[model samples]
Target chain A: MKIRPLDDRVLVQPLEEIESKTSSGIIIPDTAKEKPRIGVVIAVGTDEDLREKVKEGDKILFAKYGGEEVEIDGKEYRIISRSDILAVIED
Target chain B: MKIRPLDDRVLVQPLEEIESKTSSGIIIPDTAKEKPRIGVVIAVGTDEDLREKVKEGDKILFAKYGGEEVEIDGKEYRIISRSDILAVIED
Candidate 1:
């Protein structure tokens, strides 16, 4: 079954970041660290202005504890309100 | 100096509740109790739609961890975002 977010909400698929080395040769570990709130937009809400600003497949930056997790068709996704979105990650 | 909230925020003076006995003879103790998120709107934000919904001196219900506290002229108040407001209480 498919889920459609209502009002000024969006469905997002969170990007899980693993341990990685930075340019400074420092290892950033994901274990015990706050999960990054970055995600890709799966479905945009029906709000006209919000739809104009955010499109499907666009990457987004959301608040640290913003979205609600929902399991759909064995896939995990988050439903985030418009106010919780911090910015649209450009490029 | 008088404070004016910008955007879709509101300035509110929290209404603190004290220990009181209910009609059911249940003495509702205030000690160790979570502070109620109810307050009177001191000032409304500049957003037109928000202004239309909330007004100064209006009693409102806000999210538990929604607003930021600030002291103005020795009086404590909270700055709450529009999305954090749950409902406007009517008397």
Candidate 2:
């Protein structure tokens, strides 16, 4: 199904986090196991200011556990609100 | 020092939480020990829209762990941003 974010919300595709491990390759267990905070913007919200600040295909840093998770056609996505977005990642 | 919240931030004086004990006198420990989410608005931000929605002396419900704490004249207060404010409480 197709989805379009409304208002100041944005649709994002989360990137796989770099593995939590030491240089020696020992995996360190993260007790919290929080959701990854890096993603690429799939779509910017309808708000004018939001559209100006962010655009589709931009990499972004979002708050930990910032958005609601959804699964569509065996793929995962997140719908993030404006406050949850921390910064636009350049390059 | 006097504080005036700039932008969309609000200065608030938090109300003590009613306690985590049950009516039968069982005390439940909060593992996270998060901050309270309610307060009385001491001052509203300079944003015109914020000012129209909130005012001094209004009791409000804010987000959990939403603001920064500050002590002034031996009294405690919090600086809350607009996104952290959930709603105004009416008596």
Candidate 3:
């Protein structure tokens, strides 16, 4: 089943950070990792105002602890309201 | 000093939740308190697009961990981007 957000909500797929490696080639452990705050918009709510401002495929910066986490087809996704989105990152 | 958010950012003052009391009149401790997700908009960004959607004194629902925390004149406030706002509560 596809996940669709209600009202002004949106679905996002978080982007993973590149693993940090020390000069000696040692990899950092997950325990020390900080939460990723960036993601790509997968779907947007049907609200007319929200649809006008945001669209699918946009990369965004979101709050670290924002959104409800869900696993879809084994991939993790977050369902967040429009208010949880921070900024749209343009390349 | 007054804080003005840049771009589409907004400054918010989180509303404190009323302590829940049982019939016996026991006060709940802070440790069990959930983070407040609702706040009052103190200031809004200068972006024209954002200004049309949000206004000062509007109550909003936001991501709990989305904004940067700062203390101004001994009052706690959060600075968050427009995208982090979820919904506006009209009561």
Candidate 4:
């Protein structure tokens, strides 16, 4: 089933962080790592103002713990309000 | 010194949460408590686009773990990007 965010919410798919290793080559466990703060906008809410600021496929930086997590078709996603979106990443 | 948040960042002074007690009247320790998710906006960034969306003195809901904490003039404040803000509390 397709998930659509309502109101000022947006659906995001988080980008994976590369594993970090110490100088001794010891890999840090996931539990000890900081949460990722970047993601791609998959869907946006219907709010006129919010729609003007964000769009599908935009890479955005968000608060690490801002949104609700959901799993769809084995992939993880987050639904966050427009205010939680920090900045759009442009390359 | 007054803190002026840069870019789309905002300075927030967190609201205090009321203490909760169990049926036996035992108070929970602060360490065991959840972070406050609400705050008063003390300052907003210079970004014109962001200024249109948020304003100083607006009470907002933010991600609990989102911002960077700083102590200024005996008061605690957090500096967070606009994206870390979840919603405006209008009441």
Among the numbered candidates, top DockQ falls to: 3
lDDT of 1 by residue, A1-91 (tens): 2344545778888665431132123333457355347778988765689999999988787765675554434455666789988778766
Per-candidate clash tally:
0, 0, 7, 3
Candidate 1 DockQ category?
incorrect
- RMSD for all candidates, in order, please: 12.0, 11.6, 12.0, 12.2
The DockQ value obtained for model 3 is 0.04
Candidate 3: CAPRI quality band:
incorrect
Query: Candidate 4 on A1-91: residue-level lDDT in tens?
Result: 3444545888898776542132223333557455437778988865789899899989787777776654444566677877688788775
Q: Estimate each model's TM-score.
A: 0.43, 0.43, 0.47, 0.48
Q: Show the colliding residue pairs in model 1.
A: none
User: Can you give the lDDT of residue B85 in candidate 4?
Assistant: 74
For candidate 2, the clash count comes to 0
Stretches of candidate 4 above 4 Å error?
A1-91, B19-36
Off by over 4 Å in 2: A1-91, B19-36
Fnat (0 to 1) per candidate: 0.00, 0.00, 0.02, 0.00
Instruction: Evaluate residue B79 in candidate 1 and report its C-alpha lDDT on the 0 to 100 scale.
Output: 96
